[model samples]
Target: MKDTSMPELRAMCFADLNNAVKIIQAHDEDDGEAAEADYRDAGFDNQYVLEVDGNIVGVTGYRDVPGTDQCHWLSWTYLQQSSQGQGLGKGMLLELIEKLRSENARKIFVKVSDYEDPELGKIYQQALQVYQGVGFKEEVVSNDFYDEGENQIILGLYLRDDEDQLEEDPAVSEEKPIIRFDGLFEIAETDGAYTFSWIVKETKKLFGKRNFSVGDLQVGLESVKNEGGRKVFLTFPSNLPLIHSPLQTAGFKYVGQLQNYYEHGVHEYHFTHDLNDL
Candidate 1:
């Protein structure tokens, strides 16, 4: 049997990658591959290894979110099956949270799957509890995110006091504006999933006719369809008052949201379109 005593957390080295994959693979094969890919893509600079008697028992890390200077997303956190049930996961994660807080980080988020199997018996639920116990707050929930039954819950932990962080929506005014499709791109993390970026041009008049309509959204849907994407995801800042009308008219559904993803109190509202529906 492996030693499970005297756990230590250390920076993971390149040599630890293979061993970490094996440890996680013992419990989940797909996640093992994902962990490897994440390390290769982002490097292991922020990742840590939790060890027992110098043997790696757990891996955890955070990655910076694009367009945000201080916000991060937790990545590929996992543990050896044997090391579980002893609070090592919580200890390791708490240490990571402290590290983030000390570094003047703003917030950290994690996406957890609500997947349960008869054999596994609500495995991810325990992870949810651990995260919540460590002060993570639920931000949004996307149903059927991974499959027909499994849902995705996004949680956030604020490392700093956010009472003064809220900002007014600068783009929204008393005037009508021009909204247009900006571009389309695949969500690198999921197959058949795509997102379209858009541009909203602020107008000068208080009563200018609304330049945005269902046509703008339809154009984006066509781009997704042309790219052979089955799903189109549109996430806008919740502070925007104009996006909802066009999106609803174009057959998009509100699925979920990510809290404060754009700016403080300006959350990301999730909308989805199924190309296969037609």
Candidate 2:
């Protein structure tokens, strides 16, 4: 039987990064490199490393979601391959949850992938099971998010059940529409599926007689489809009522919302348009 003793969780430091990279690489080489780069660029102020008998075996961390106080995102939760499959992942996750709860985190979220390949699917399945076992609920599944046939699964755990007090939308000023097409970028693609993101730079500009229109959206969608994109995603603050109509007219279906995403009472809504269905 594997030892069930809890591993020591210590604040990660720049000096510990080499060991962390090795631990992550043991599971995924590309991800390990990305994690190391992210740590270097962002720093490890909120990260922690798990140590078992003075040997670094894993790493985990959390970051406050921008524009919110109570919401947080799980970051870089990884364990060495040699240390996995022995119930260590659950223990580490529980510890991380406790840490977040103690810090008064009202909600925590994480993203996992659903891959088309059976072998790759099994890995994420185990991950999803772990998160679900710890009370994480599947909140959103962005189809073709990562690439063709690989979906992004967002899970959330609410530590507190406080009811949100909805706030009224503020009056809009009559000014030139300040919106800009942030650019269309490829989100993910595979042989069977391809997804792209259309980002609207400013919501306030959505109300005025602007260059953006339902027709514009249709053209963009068609252009992407012609280029072989199977899916397209767009997100915006729910407070922008004017934006919703055009999006709906463009045949974008509402996927889900992230509550308290922008501020208390406001939300970020996710919408997707499937080219194949159209």
Q: lDDT per residue, candidate 2, 1-278, as tens digits? A: 32357775789999999999988787667668878888998899879999887888889988787667678888888877788887778888888888887887878889887765556544667778989999988778887776666778998777765554334544433233334453465552233343334344454433655536787787778878887777788777667666777888889999998765655556678898988777
Clashes of each: 0, 4
The window of 10 residues in a row where model 1 has the poorest summed lDDT is 167-176
Residue-level lDDT tens digits of model 1 in 118-178: 8978778888998999999897876655555666788988888755244454443332357
- List candidate 2 segments past 4 Å from native: 1-4, 119-121, 164-179, 188-212, 215-230, 275-278
Q: Model 2 compared with the native: what TM-score?
A: 0.77
- Which has the greatest lDDT? 1
State model 2's lDDT: 0.74
Count: clashes, candidate 1: 0
Model 1 misses residue 238 by how many Å?
3.2
